[model samples]
Target: MLSYNSLSLYLQVVINLTLLTGLILLVRNGIKTMEVIMLFLSGEFALELTDLVDRLLKLNTLNTYNYALSQFLGLVMLTEIYSRYFLKVPAFVKWIIYGYAMIFLVINIMDIYHRAPVTFYSNIISSIIICSFAAAYCVKILQKGKVEKSLFIVNTFVFLFFLLNA
Candidate 1:
């Protein structure tokens, strides 16, 4: 009788863990940093871990840790991939990362105080935004057949949960 979101979150974590293990292996294998492999692996690991914490604690069903992590981690992985594949951006991207982290920090404080359903639901909304941007970037890369090695594992993690109900 669990909600679909919870069900998906659980499956996503499992897939993400699997992807993270693969990323760790790739990191050990070579290819250095920011390879297609590295970006994907890092994203998968950070994202999945964030979701796992939310699940384990049963906090903020909508505005969960996973939700917050999705935005932050998306920025991290995208930066890695873009920096590797495209132009080197301004150093401000680091501050951008910090910005997202700060927002998450606030959300955590709110979690302790309010524990509102809105907090958990906010995760769903943020995740949707993250997913949309990711999908667009993924499509651009997929078209070129030039995805980061890590992306394949990340894709597996994302897809596995979305289809788990089947």
Candidate 2:
């Protein structure tokens, strides 16, 4: 019989694989925005798979590396998706987001080398930034007086959940 932790890991693998399949299908048939979102989901799936492998192999420190890489890439992808799809922000704002993402990526890379422990700081920073982006998107949609109710509601709740879970 599988232990609880092993069962959880197996469940996560299954969920991520399902999400990966849906994302792949959406990317094949959807718009440009779907491409960015697909990349984000793909990264997530890859990291989860890495986690499963690490668990099965009893690897040393692979989770830290996988997590750091995922956080950085997730932030970059989220910035792109939010700026392009969720917000009607100016180009300068998008550039600023990209700049921040680049800086965060560098910090994470440094953390991967210098920090012996897991990069919780980088994860927290990325989570907060993503949550802020979702909040800002909601505010923008409200201000614009024509809300894409589904997008606004779904993304807002998702990011809030991300923040709390983070």
Candidate 3:
């Protein structure tokens, strides 16, 4: 029987592999959003691999920092993707997103500087922001009355992923 840590490591490896495969496929297809998505996936894949190595090396401090960085980048990348998904993203809304990301980054940096444990509040906030983006995308699709199967599928998964995380 696998220990809990071993099982978790295996799962992480599997997820990393899946993300890599998706990145490759997205690149080959030359989708309009390919660059943003590929960047997101690549960054996440690198961070996750770093996390795995940190864990194996028993570097708890580095793992915590990695997690914080991953959450911050994920927030930015997902926001960018959602902003581009809409034909008309409001200027004020974009400013709000930018402000929120800045605040989050500041909080993380402060925590790291003080050698404080990172807080879950940032994760919760990030999840809420992403879920809202997903909801807006859904509303946009409804208003357009034309569903692109691929987008719908991606939107559904994103919403579910964030919802569960929240």
Ranking by lDDT: 3, 2, 1
Candidate 2, 69-102: lDDT as tens digits: 7766777777777777787667886677677667
Q: What's the candidate order when arranged by decreasing TM-score?
A: 3, 2, 1
lDDT tens readout by residue for model 3, 18-130: 66666676666677655777788789879988988988898978887787788778888887777776435677976887778778777876677554444567778788888
Instruction: Tell me the lDDT of model 3 at 75.
Output: 84
Candidate lDDT values, in order: 0.57, 0.68, 0.74
Error of 2 at 51 (Å): 2.2
Worst 10 residues of 3 by lDDT: 112-121
Q: In model 1, which regions exceed 4 Å deviation?
A: 1-16, 35-101, 142-166
The runs of at least 3 residues in candidate 2 whose Cα sits more than 4 Å from the true structure, single-residue gaps closed, are 1-33, 89-118, 157-161
Write model 1 residue lDDT over 1-166, tens digit each, in one string. Answer: 9997777777766667676676767666665654664766676566667666766666655445455456455545555554454434457854665566567656755665564564455445445434544565567776888865654554444444333312
What is candidate 3's CA lDDT for residue 132? 82
Each prediction's total of clashing residue pairs, residues at least 3 apart in sequence or on different chains, is 12, 0, 0
Q: Best-fitting candidate, measured by lDDT?
A: 3
Positional deviation of residue 140's Cα in model 3 after best superposition, in angstroms: 2.1
> Candidate 1 vs candidate 3: which has greater lDDT?
3
| Candidate with best TM-score | 3
